[model samples]
Target: MAKELDLIEEFRDLSLVCEVTPRSVKLGMLKLTNSFLEKVKECQKRDRKLSEKLVLIDEGKEDDF
Candidate 1:
């Protein structure tokens, strides 16, 4: 929730800095940015979980060669 609000504020500031002319275009860009950020975060979380699982497996199993 707070993260989302921070992102929204950042987008607004970016748009202001870039001098984006139209409100609709600014909004469209913001939505795309938000969606991309969410996907990246989700991927990072999944990767972390997979890494932890791999570590656990390595610790629990013994090589039989």
Candidate 2:
């Protein structure tokens, strides 16, 4: 029937839209993940430097006593 054909067309269009929507969302999530990872790396580097400084300070204090 013509009505069945119309319903099928509508379903196909909706399916295509649903598939494309997730791909765009996935791309956006990838970008956000990369940005977050970069920030984490920078924080880790700063933390490592601070830890090294603390160790040096502790060593100097032990020498004084």
TM-score of each: 0.26, 0.25
Q: Model 1, range 35-61, lDDT digits (tens) per residue?
A: 888898888777976667767778886
Across 1-65, the per-residue lDDT of candidate 2 in tens digits comes to: 67755665665655432222422321121222488889988887789766677677788853331
Summing lDDT over every window of 10 consecutive residues in candidate 2, give the lowest-scoring window.
Answer: 23-32
Question: Where does candidate 1 clash, by residue pair?
Answer: none
- What lDDT score is found at residue 53 in candidate 2? 70
**Per-model lDDT:** 0.62, 0.55
Q: After TM-score superposition, what is the CA distance of residue 6 in candidate 2 from its true location, in Å?
A: 28
- The regions of model 1 sitting more than 4 angstroms off are 16-26, 29-65
lDDT score for residue 63 of model 2: 37
